[model samples]
Target: MTKGLDLHFPHQTGFLSLTAAAVSHQFVNEAKNWTEAQSHCRSHYTDLATLYNTDDVNALTQLGSPTGSAWIGLYDDLIDSWRWSITNSSFYGPGETEFRNWNVPQEPNNAFGQELCAHMQSDGTWNDLPCASAFINFVCYGGNDQYVLINQGRTWNDAQSYCRANYIDLPSIRNATENEKVQVVANGNNVWIGLYRTRTWSDGSDSSFRHWNSSQPDNLNGQQHCTAMSFSDAGQWTDEDCATTLPFFCYIADRPTVVTLRAVVDAADELTEAEIEETILKPLREELIRNGLPNSTSLRLRKVYQTNP
Candidate 1:
């Protein structure tokens, strides 16, 4: 074969690792509804926080805020529509967005088709309640997986803001063991968990990651449309209404997407450096674009001289 060329995707700011991408996050301590929060984030930064992965969710828990909850970029124009809080598509994988855990594993209901908000019940089960009902206590966790349960009650939206500003998004339970950890801190009270089904991102990204606290998304009262991260059982998702305005989350993203590449070739023709860049490396970039890669990225090239084998 001809001489080889290498490709790399570096960070926009600095020389991060080859596998790193550059993303920025900024938090707004102001209290606002979901609609209001998005407007503020878009105006000041990018938009209300969006989650690329569980890591993104965990990172927000580290922020510090005084309110019990705030608002996030996640919202649904359709009753049961769901999506990620952020607009990026690279963070999703197969069967990731569809992950869900319901108390009633057999036949689940949609909060009886009532409203659009969700909260955790005692024992970590979920229920669809009105989001605008009132504020309630919520649990906040950190990147190290440490958590603090807020005794004071706040609206679901309010709770989210508090956790994000102070810690991370509502507790994201991975298994029954982790759920037990949250249950102890719950103190026998039904607290909010991070699970819901509003099938549409405010930024218009699609995600199918669902973690219901069992018997969730029931659509009870036909009014619950929003969601809360429940803590009673483990950290399951619940449904609630948008108007209820419970303590909720306000998030910022710290996502980066950096890629690095290196190549080795048998130098028989001994082509010039420019020929390698134009004939070989240039095609690689074009192919990446054809595959629908983001065009706003900054690309660079590097050269190394080695004696032929």
Candidate 2:
């Protein structure tokens, strides 16, 4: 719906129609803190990426290394306020978006300082980390339905830049099946998963789907606020500091579009009833064919006339 971007698909549920769309994701090889990472992505392509289904996670995993973890677009801005990538209040309820799979008792202790970035472990759990600590890989999501996983070691900010330049921004994971798919690909690496408190999608969609490990989101130590995926227990989650930088993933979207087009012809300018078909109706048919529309398509047109208004 924007410039230089078009949505194209044979058929899609609840969407627009266009000639075609160009959606995709990329993997960056830099690092920075969570905030910096997001900024980097916004400056270049769209924003941090967000996930929707199993296909999204699985596709991203295929592009990533089966070792390290990547950054996604999830964080815990509030102590107990959890949200998704999209900021639509009406889409999800209080308990609807609260999906966490922490490793329990040991994670989210806020061990260091202000942790606010989310990541995924190779195993597919989650954790919260500091936004400006050391360095970790990261990822970004954009476009229609797309994702990417990078295999670089940098701070969150650095990773964001790399993604923006090469791909989109960090990605967001939406459902459990998607989480599991990502887990299988992680292969025991601590990658980033798109989840956090007060979540919002890069494309601004409200899809409620969470897969936290067991006894997670402890928000321990009051400092641990960010989120991440874990490897120890089937891709669960844990709260950590955001300052700890890491690698990440990025993506773009070009989802299939479906549009309903209609035309309302004004019959007020018609001729006499006796001359109707010959003067107005028959020519309309010829005009459609002249315009290059398929004859079959035109033949399917339903004949309807406004009797009142």
Candidate 3:
């Protein structure tokens, strides 16, 4: 365990396996108020790390010692319910509100009339604390999938919104092969994907299902709250805290053929011969000329002879 922090771990039967995946980063509450703590978390580490589910919580618990509580990135004051600072949205998963393991007692009791901090105790339960109390340190998970790279940088929330606005769900992997493909493209950077435990799909619904790699999506820390793709590893999927501001991946869905054409012109049928010649043929001719095709090539017009009168 690191000095003042109580970092615990699960018992391993064989050689203790310690991969970058198992390491987690946390922040300490140092007399900083809510807003200040939020800023410190954002500026220092990734955003306040949000728990995905029970599995994620368990994994994080290993990082603690036998004593002391750790602060997480969950709070209810900004919104009506518990929300992640990374996405600034409510935490999604099976039994969101009823999950006692994550929350001690339907809290956000807004206790002290100003409770906005959460900590993990030695027993693995969560307790709400005053934001100004400087007794807690938080944890962070860093892996390849926590971040997304784009032409320009953006917040995880922005990345998620951009994917939803432009594509189907965030990018999803159908199998290990696809995951490997994504990893190759990602290189060493983390990217976002379309797999979250927001809700289960309906019976017979194909679009909502996720095919995780074998032995994957262990929901490591708590609930497998966030989704990321690993490149150094086997392009496998890993669950992470959403607030961990790592890079994210974004994708644009294939637009309908008609919509694509309309984007270039008002409508395909509305294009005039002159317009086509000016916009299409002229450009092609210029490109051909640039490529060494003869610009002066000409053809003789054929005429038909009249027979009568």
The clash count of every prediction, one per candidate, is 116, 125, 37
In what order do the candidates fall by lDDT, top score first? 1, 2, 3
How do the residues 155-258 of candidate 1 rate in per-residue lDDT, one tens digit apiece?
66677667766665566555665567777888877776655445555655433355554677676666655555433333345665666544344433346466
Candidate 2, residues 1-309, lDDT tens digits: the string is 422212221221121122223446565657666666667667765655555444445555565556555556666555454434433334345555566766566565444434456677655667777645345555555435455556666655565456545554444455575566556555566765545434444444333345455666565666555555443344444555667675555555444342233334444432222133334434544564466532212221223334334
Pairing residues by index, what is the TM-score of model 1?
0.37
* lDDT tens digits, residue span 107-128, model 3: 4344423344443344333455
If ranked by TM-score, best first, what sequence of candidates would result? Answer: 2, 1, 3
Runs in model 2 with CA error above 4 Å?
Answer: 1-22, 79-198, 230-237, 254-309
Give residue 238's lDDT in candidate 2 (0 to 100). Answer: 56
Once fitted onto the true fold, the runs of candidate 3 whose alpha carbons sit more than 4 angstroms away are 1-24, 27-32, 78-309
List TM-score per model, in order. 0.37, 0.38, 0.20
Q: Which numbered prediction scores highest in lDDT against the true structure?
A: 1
Error of 1 at 92 (Å): 9.7
